[model samples]
Target: MCLLLGVLVGRAVPWMQGWRTRAAHRAAEQKLDALYSQYDDIYHRWDE
Candidate 1:
């Protein structure tokens, strides 16, 4: 499943690299999981 998904994503990689695609990706990522913010907060909390 992961391998097939990788191939599928590979086919879309060019589109994913475009600015419009990136914006949509960002929006979808944020909606799916706030991993970016949580990751930053984890590091900052460790620093503190």
Candidate 2:
């Protein structure tokens, strides 16, 4: 039915958007953590 398809599509769009947003957030967090670790390593080396 057209109505059923419409409903399914409506629900799917938001779900897909949310999934993409979460994935992006996770990637950004990982990048930030990597950067922090690299900075920390450099700082430690400088201290020695």
Q: Score residue 32 of candidate 1 by CA lDDT.
A: 64
Worst 10 residues of 2 by lDDT: 1-10
Which RMSD values do the candidates have, in order?
A: 12.1, 1.2
> Model 2, 1-48: lDDT tens per residue?
999999999999999999999999999999999999999999999999
Give a tens-digit lDDT track for model 1, residues 1-48: 999999999878777679677799889988667877887899999999
Candidate 1: which stretches are off by over 4 Å?
1-27, 31-33
Question: What's the lDDT for residue 45 in model 2?
Answer: 100
The model with the greatest lDDT is 2
Per-model TM-score, in order, reads 0.35, 0.80
The candidate maximizing TM-score is 2
Residue 43, candidate 1: Cα error in Å is 0.4
